[model samples]
Target: MRQILLFAALAAVLALLLVSCGGTKDKPVPTEEDAPGKAAYHKISAEEAYEMMISQEIVVVDVRTREEYDGGHIENAVLVPNESIGSEMPETLPDKEATLLIYCRSGRRSKDAAQKLLALGYQSVYDFGGVIDWPYELVKEG
Candidate 1:
């Protein structure tokens, strides 16, 4: 009977330890974080993206390959390949607060990059469709 009681006490202590070390469940996930400083996902059209670019200091991100980017892209968009974006913040996008305008060959990769950026806690991510749909003049890297 004494041994059983001791085993029960040990089991209780172990359970308490597990609960303490399991981490908190209240913390928001990257994409769901919407507090003042936290990031949120926002979708915008190509025209709206252009307007924001002209009116604001937004960073245009081309989530395409170097070859794809050299072919043609927005005036000053930086290259951050979709495959490169993972758990870590991208090198080209240092400011998590900067308004990120994402684009790719078509609408598909842009959406993917946007989701990844959101998951990485990047605020104000705007996906502007594809370069093929962009009405503005595209500049090819010389």
Candidate 2:
């Protein structure tokens, strides 16, 4: 009887788990930050980002400081410092539904800034890692 009860309990737990961990057919593919009270953002490669920039009307965001941005950045990239992002929507990023491609000097701050932008209700946000990984040419501010 003891062994039977143990098997029954194990089966019950397994059934519960299967029900709880159901398929996400209705929901979009979730990112690492996708969770309760958290936001979701896509992490793409620099090459992918470049393609998107040319193929579509997307916003390239440089989440680095003014000094860093002045040094060098992708052509047509807008400077939106990560430190400046707050609860309110930034004036520079007026369109919440516009596709945003965010990057930083070393990829860390870009991810952080992407999450914040999603939380701010931005529909499409992508982090293409750090500019250091970018093999393409970068234009310097005059």
Candidate 3:
């Protein structure tokens, strides 16, 4: 009887361990509803980005190469190439809690940069996809 009780207790402990260890591996997708100090990042549309740009003070980041940026980019957008970002926080982006609107030539780099920024403790990061999809006016470098 003593042996049986010990075995039952061990089995219950093992079951609890297994239950606690089981969890989803997938990352949570950030939504438009995500606010600063709440979520890591938010995926928004070009129109939504435009509204935020006009209505509030936001840091518009073009996460593309210098050459690409020189070709043309959204007005007031600063060049902060995705390749330039590393483990260290970017110098151009000083404030971690600032509202950042990130973009690239296409949607891929923007997503990657946004994730990196979030990992660096940025409180308010928004990925607005590619500049190719931007219908608004662009400023070309001289």
lDDT of 2 by residue, 13-93 (tens): 987887787634446666656665444678999999999988999999999999899898999999999999999998999
Candidate closest to the true structure, highest lDDT: 2
In order, what lDDT does every prediction score? 0.88, 0.91, 0.90
What residue runs in model 2 are displaced by over 4 Å at the alpha carbon?
1-39
Rank candidates by TM-score, best first: 3, 2, 1
Cα lDDT tens digits, model 3, 1-142, are: 9999999999999889877776356456656645435656689999999999999999999999999999999998988999989999999999987899999988999999999998888888999999999999999999
Candidate 1 residue lDDT tens string, 40-107: 66778889999999999999999989999999899999999999999999888999888899999888
Clashing residue pairs in all predictions, respectively, total 0, 0, 0
Ranking by lDDT: 2, 3, 1
| Residue 113, candidate 3: alpha-carbon lDDT | 98
What is the overall TM-score of model 3 with all chains considered together? 0.74
Q: Any runs in candidate 3 off by more than 4 Å, and if so which? A: 1-38
